[model samples]
Target chain A: MEQFDNVSVSKRANVYFDGLCVSYTVTLADGTRKTVGVIQPSKLVFNTGAPEVMELVEGECRVVLPGESEAKTFKGGESFSIPGNSSFNIEVVSALHYVCHYG
Target chain B: MEQFDNVSVSKRANVYFDGLCVSYTVTLADGTRKTVGVIQPSKLVFNTGAPEVMELVEGECRVVLPGESEAKTFKGGESFSIPGNSSFNIEVVSALHYVCHYG
Candidate 1:
């Protein structure tokens, strides 16, 4: 879907990595929490508290998931999974727009 | 309120000024359109296509409205209005989180 319907969205954004990453918290009708965000062209490591599915809405990036050595390129319409209590390294070739789902 | 409830928010973001300003379009149930956005610390001029009421959720900035000489400083919990087809200049002293309400 191009948008989320009947959802609650926080006004304040979550800014990370000196503003390289910015996202808004979205709460679905079922109380599932997601984040809609953008990552500028940069390389960054993100640590996760819960397992996450990063669904790319647009742009391109190469990600090295935890316990992996080779980076995998993911673009718009693609997604990658990150294990809980772990981290992943991502190199954004272009600005990345994504929706992050927590598990 | 800290959030917008029962709204439809677009998945993609509107990135401007080379990622200095990022915003997401939100559509209310009644079809009113708004945007939740963040502006990094910088000086920029923005033209308005429609009259706008910029509600600042957090951060600091000085703005010069169209046809004005001196700039005014505004912070969180404040708001400024711009006429349609006009423009304004803003200097963000800190990262600005805002909701843009269109008329």
Candidate 2:
């Protein structure tokens, strides 16, 4: 039988992007772990192969997709997805905390 | 030209789920908005139709799928995706913050 434990978020490390700091942690079956803070725009677009990814921001939400040719807005507490292999831009208009995951 | 503004997160409303609180907001193209806090499990499964969805938890990440019969784990700052039309369960085992978005 295999037993695994849950990973905890570290207080010292939190991901900061735009102007927001998103909290997160990574845990593996063997109990290995790591902490990360702040996901940068370059990283967001880097190797964009995963099906999910998230960025946190503070204040208002402004989303501009070059292909869409239109800006879509989002409110705090509202979550949306940015499709894979698409070029898009996002900014944290205010102060907000967002957590994202990809498959 | 159609002008749209970004949405902000309300200090009063923060979404809580399982044992963790998720920060988010929903902004529209027309500026209509609402504040929400804490996403319940029933609600996570209620809509059930979207390309992406996310959940946050504190401590070690433990993912269990009945179909696969395997448990996958995640660390803080590590994001993954949950495919559309899949059944799953998550718990915020610690005092942590997590944000989830769906499209």
Candidate 3:
């Protein structure tokens, strides 16, 4: 029940690695778009344009907030937040499946 | 990549048990839409509106065609096709993650 069945998509892309890591995007209902991202076994930095919520839907990864020194590991069902115009780093232990919410 | 990063969804729903199983919809680029379906450990009879390609993204399941008696087991990376206005039966062994394509 964490996802919807009546979802519609207008645009789509695959394996966007112009940045540090690779990820994909899916726009959900109400014009709400999200990135169902997957990170390989590597480290990457990402800057957000809007305040975003990172939801771990599958697999796991380690994340470091903008002001944090210690990176924390997150598994499925866990989530973190990043303010707009902010940046964060992630260390993918294995393959990670995540949904990035834009607001 | 099997999925797109620029995907968009305009409408969404969840756990549609009004049918034989539960599934969700997402519209992708080029006005393409798909159902991220999850089948429980049960047998289900489903009728298709259009020609559909059932892609098993996770877990495993057994499928029986309209005129077939022997069910076939399919795992991740496997797929099957159903003609439009046709009905097929599925026997889910575990939780199955699938992307149902319509054409």
Tell me, per candidate, how large a share of the native contacts it keeps: 0.81, 0.00, 0.05
Q: Find the candidate with the highest lDDT and give its number.
A: 1
The candidate that wins on TM-score is 1
- Looking at model 1, residue B83 earns an lDDT score of 95
lDDT of 1 by residue, A1-103 (tens): 9999999999999999878899999999999999999999999999999999999999999999898899999999999999999989999999999999999
Which pairs, if any, clash in model 1? none
What is the CA-based DockQ of model 2?
Answer: 0.02
Ranked candidates (TM-score, high to low): 1, 3, 2
| Candidate 3 local Cα displacement, residue A67, angstroms | 29
State the lDDT of candidate 3 residue by residue for B10-88, as single tens digits. 2222333332244445655566877665555677788888999998876688999877889999987889999999999
Candidate 2 chain B lDDT trough over 10 residues, lowest sum: B1-10
Per-residue error for A101 in candidate 2, Å, reads 1.8
Q: Rank the candidates by lDDT, best first.
A: 1, 3, 2
**Each candidate's lDDT (Cα)?**
0.96, 0.40, 0.66
